[model samples]
Every structure is written in structure tokens, then in C-alpha cells.
Target: MGDHDINEDHAQASDAPPRAGDGPRTAQAKGAVSRWTRRVHKIYIICFHRGFAAFLVLPLVLALVFVAQKNHFGADQCKARESGCGFVGNEDAYGLGIRLGVYLQWLSVFLVVYLLPSEERSLMTSLITFSSALMMAILVLTFGGTCTYTVEIIVLLWTAFMTQALASITHTAQEIDDAGIREVPVISGLKRATTFQLNLDSPQGMHGFQSGSTLVEMCILGYAAWFWVCLLRGAEMVFAATPCGTSLFFFARIQDRKGIVVISALMTAVSLATLLFRLAAWIFRTSVKRWFSKRTYDMLGAVLVSIVYLPITLIAGITYLVPDTWMLKMFPGSGGREQLMVFLCAFVAFIVSVAGIELLLVWNGISDVYGVGSTGQLIPLTMGLVSLMPILWKLLRRYMAGEPLVPEPASNGSGLLIRGTALPHQGSPVEMAARQSDREALQLP
Candidate 1:
């Protein structure tokens, strides 16, 4: 009996299928899955907080501006040994039209990135890019402006469209159930209708949860108004000085003074409207206090990173990491890295505060740090310097006040939203409370 039983058991063991994790192929498959999961996690992290990350492109924008300074195309500042070539003032209105256009471009980008989330975010960003591209395309066709930013805008537009298409695949939402609280899915796809409505929609009206905000958005709104007013006045000067803009609006080939004022006024109206929306957004941000706290620091850090490092990274990647046919045309020089390096050195000097060195060394001395072949081609050198003053001033003020360089984001880690159908085991009171909050966050109506 014993011998037959032992023989039967050995036979059953031999006949059993190999375990899932035992073979080389299984190991390889597991490894591949792990790698893919990690890659996805990385992408989500990088893309999710892109508003703060937008500062990374600041250097690229600067590259577009100062590329003209590397050649003979720039103004008197190009001729000076010190390179902070503020706009050549030879043009009417100290070139305020150009100034207005450039600052608006930066603000437009910041708003799109900062205001929205996921597919909605990308769509808005793409819409803004499309409008700018259309305007720039017309301007280039008629008169002239930098094509590099146009190309960048188009690329971003395409990326946003692609992101919109893939949003469902990348993002996932979980359901939160509060025992009796997870009663019913009231409004189909909307958040759940709970017994007691969540405070997220209404007011919390307490400052304890929020950190130092200074209502920076409101401050920026006021600043934008002042800036646009100056720009409008400057536009008036240019329009009075030259009638080309308004004439072109009506398709008249000859230069006409009336057209410039009309065109400038139209642009002023659009700029004011844009600022109004931004103001509304900032007001909305006050309600989401914890989510939007430390906004100024985020803005400052992003700007500094863009100003300090983006050019070097873009150039290196353009040269070594990606194909370079378009970059060569966009940058018009191989010497950009050197200029960027020099700028870095100057920044370092400013940091050390060596021997009573003036800010002119850092502020007005960064021109001619980019283009190599831009002698008579697309020179945006002058207004480029002016465009950054608003952001830089904001950052420097924050710096002097001893505020944080890199802002710490508020944690919204509490919540009980489970991703799937599995029920949770018994846990402590704190754990149960966290789970309940998670469901409340989902608020599945």
C-alpha cells in the first residue's frame, strides 16, 4: 500500500505543469513588464506638474532672443563690449510693439501650463500655440519675426494633440466608498452625491492649512496691468511714428500712419482681455489655497532654471542626442554653449558678490551669448532682454526677502479611493480615517 501510494504521488508531481516564475522566458517577461511600468511612472511624474517645469524652457526662449547679438544684426549694445543690448531705441516707441508681443507670448505659455490639468491642459495649451503660430505666420509673411519660436509652438501643438488622444490611457481615477457613505452613483460619471457635500466646492475659510501665498497671482495681475499700460503707450509712439501696421491690416501695400494706431489699439484690447482672464484664474486659485500655495517660489525657481541651464541642455541634446538639421537653422550658431557658459560664470560672480561688482555685469551683460550666424538674419536681441525683466524682478525680490528658492508643494495624501473591487482587511483607526477621506476625495456622484 505504501509503495503504490509513493509511486502515485511521484507520478502526479512529474505530470504537474511548470510553475509560472520558474523559466528564463518568464523571468525576461517579468523584467520587461517592470521596465515598462517604471517608464510610465516616470512620464506621469514629469508631465503632471509641468506648470512648475515650464521654467525649464526659459533658456530656450532666451536663446531665441539673443541669437541676433552673436552677429552684426543687433543694435548698439551689440557694438558695445558689454552685451546686455537693451533694445536699440532707434525704432519708434522704443519698440514697444515688439515688447508687448514678446511678454504676452511668455505670459500665454505660463497661463496655459499652470491653469489646467491633463487633456484639458494640453488642449488649452495647443489652442494658445495655434493662435500664436497663426499670428506669427502672418507677421513673418508680411514683415518678420523669429521662426524658431514658431517651430517650437507647432511642435508643442502637435504634442498637445497627441497628449489629448492618449490622456485616457495615461490617467486613471479610483472610486471612493464610505461604507454607508459610498451609497450610490447619483450623477452617472460625475462625482457621487454624498450625504454631506464636500467642502472642496464651498469655502474652508481658514488660513491654518495654507502657507505663504502673498496672493502672488493677484500681484502678478496688477503687474501685468502696469506693464501692458507702458507697452500701450510705447505702441502709441510707434504707431504715431509709422503707419504701416494699420495699412497692412486693410491689405494696403503702402505705409500709412492710421493703420499702426488701429493695429496697436486692437492688440492692446486683446492683451487686456488676456490679463482679465488671468486675474479670474488667480481669484479662483485663492479657493484652492493648499493646492496653489508657494506659487511665487515655483515661478522664480522655474525662471532661474530656464535662464541658467536650458540653453546648454538644449544645445547638447540637439547636437548629440537628436538630429540637428532644424536646430542649426533655429540657433544659427555652434558657439551658443560657450556663451551660455560665460553667462553661467557671470551668474556665479553675481552670487559671490565679489569686490563691489555691480548688477550690470549680470543684468546688462548677457547679450551676444547665443547666435553665431545671425549677423543680418532674424535678430530679436533687444526686446529679448526687456521681456525677462518682469520675471527676473519678481524672482530677485523673492530672493532678497529670504523666501524659499524651491517651493514645497502641499501634500494631499489622505484618501480612501481603491482602484479595484477588492475589499480592505481590518486596520487601525487612523488607517480607516485615511481610507474614508480618500473616498471623500473621489466623491463619486
Candidate 2:
């Protein structure tokens, strides 16, 4: 009977389910495996994204360096009064190598753009690539070694500015899409205010240049106009100060004190004006929320911004009309004192502009209209760091800390957890109860 009972007990024990401890052990193993898997996945994603970005940017850098070197040599030749010193003047092996490199780099840009994933390749990216390639071709064919260093620098700066501005606009548009606020009434009104259409079928339209336009197109036109004016004015100032015999190699020697003054003053004025406009809009929006619709307030805000910005533009234009000497006289200083003043003005201007733009985007319902949060902060931060090192560094830090690259979806009070599963208690309830009893007993008198 004892032998039979022992056999039955053994069978029952063998057939029974796993111990309670085994479940936790299995879960721990799973958690560890998942953690490692996530780390590997993160590393792969970082490598992929950054590698692609670097590939896209490399051609532009190489092209700029090669073209600038070639142009510098050509400019040097021209300055020496050498015969046949023009864009096509250089046929030496070195010159040919530079030209070949430039051509290859330009081609590489197109190739890289083509290789981008379809989802990543947008109209703006195409346009930027095309424009950059066209500009490079023009510079190579027309200017060659004959172009002044100042002219070369200006062209490069203009290209970079245009690229950055278009990128910003594209990013903003994407944010708007992601926020799902494209159909917002205030946004629609703003779009309408900025956009214009011309009817070619109408008799009056035949005489006038008319076509459909978008907010992006309008912003482009405005940027182009502003940049051209600033470039021309700044160029005039630089040329006037720079001597004819100034070496092309020492391009920085070109006195741009006047240019600095004008830019600093203009930036300061515009930044202050933007801040004031933001404040006024906020006050108006708050005060009239009960009296007027949001769309109306937004439209009024747009009008107010335009009114404020227009005067600043006009004033800048009028200043450009005045002589540089006259402008300089307005800010009285000489030597180091003048330089210090210029530095202060520029510093102040930059600080104020950053602050103003940040407030305008965050507080003025701009981000709300676009359906973004603190991500909008990236617009200002990343715009200034075109090299993208900071962004990459941020990603690396986040990954190392085991934090997510993208922000978690904000809680909407739905009480539905999106991230981790519920974890079991570290100690069993019975063990906890025993510990509590011990502490209670120890405290008893």
C-alpha cells in the first residue's frame, strides 16, 4: 500500500504545472531578451538615418570646396594680369582635376537625391537639389577663376540661405500635416489671405499675370525679395569699403563694418517688432475671445502682423536708399569702440530674434494650428545648426539612456496604457505580510 501511494504521489508531482517561481523567471528572461533586442534595433535605426543624411550632404560639401579652390586659383591668375585669364583660362592638370571633381560632385548630388526613399523624397527636396545643381553649373561655367571671392562668397551664402529657408518651410508643413490641423479654420483663413489666384479665362486676366499660388510660394517670394535686397545692399557696402588690390585669399579683410551695422540694426528692429506684434495679438485674442470668432481674431492677428512687418520692411528699404556713411553716422563710434558697438548690436539682435520667434511659435497658436508641441522648438534650434551634429548628438544621448527617440503620445485621460505591461511585485504578498508583522511586533511595548 505504501509503495502504491508513493508511486501515485510521484506521478502526480511529475504531471503537475510549473512552480509559481518559474513564471517570474520566464518573464525575467523575456524582459532581458526584449531589452537587448530594442537596443540593437535602436542602433540599426540610428546608423541607417545618419548614414543616409551624411551621404546626402557630402556631395554639397565636396562641391563647395573644389569649386571654391578652383575659383580662387582663377581669381589669383586674373589678379596677376595674366593673358587669357577667364573662366576657361585654366587648362592645367590641377585645374582639370578640380573641374572634374566639381562636375562629379554636382552629379553625385542628383544621384543621392534619386537614391532617397520615395517617402523621403518630396517636391521641396527635388527643388532644392535642382536649384543647387543649377547654381553650381552656372558658377562653374560663367565665373570660373574670374569671379571675385566676395562674389563667390555671396553666391554661396545666398544658396545656403535659400536652402535653409525652404527646408524650414517644408518642416513646418510636415509638422502641420502630422498635427492633423490642415483643415483648421484659422489655418485655412491664413492660407487664403496669403494665396492669390488669377483667372486666365477672364478678359482682365489676359492682360495681368495671373496664376494659382500657395502659402509656401508666397513665403518663397517674400524670402527671395528680402534676401536679394539685403544681399545687394550688403554687397554695395562691402565693395565700397574693400580696396581694389585686396588679395582674393584674404576675403575676410574686406571691411564689412557698414554691412554689419545695417544687418544688426535691421535684425534688432524686426525682432522687436515681431515681439510687440505677438504681444498685441495675444492681448487681442484673449480680450475678444467672447466677442469674436477664433478665425476672425486670427485673421485680425495676421493683418496686424503684416502691418507691423510691412513698415519695418519699408524702413529697411528706405535705409538702403540712404548712403552707408549716413547710416554709420547715426551710430557714433570709432575704432574698437565701433567694433564693440557692432558686436553688441549683433548679439542683442540674435538673442531677441530667437526669443521672439520662440514665443511667437509657442504662444501665438502657431504650433497649435500646425498640430505640434515642443517639437516646434526644433525649428529654431536646428535651423541655426545646419551641420546637424547637435541633432545627432541628441539622438545618441537619448539612445544611450534607453529613452525613446520619439516622444511618447501625451496622455488623453483614456486610462489605456500604451507602453510597458504590468510588472509583478518584487516580493510575495505573504512575505510582505510576514515582514509587516515582524515590524509591528518589534514596535510593540
What would the TM-scores of all predictions be? 0.20, 0.22
Go through the candidates in order and give each one's C-alpha lDDT: 0.29, 0.33
lDDT tens digits by residue: candidate 1, 235-311: 32211111112112222332344554464455445434433433333333223334554566345434433443444
Indicate the residue-level lDDT of 171 in model 1. Answer: 11
lDDT of 2 by residue, 2-70 (tens): 234323422432323445767877765565444433333332222221222222333444453345334
Best by TM-score: 2
- Give the count of colliding residue pairs in each prediction: 15, 1
**For candidate 2, what is the lDDT?**
0.33
Considering summed lDDT, which 10 consecutive residues are worst modelled in model 2? Answer: 409-418
Question: How high a TM-score does candidate 1 get?
Answer: 0.20
For candidate 1, give the lDDT of residue 411. 15
Worst 10 residues of 1 by lDDT: 205-214
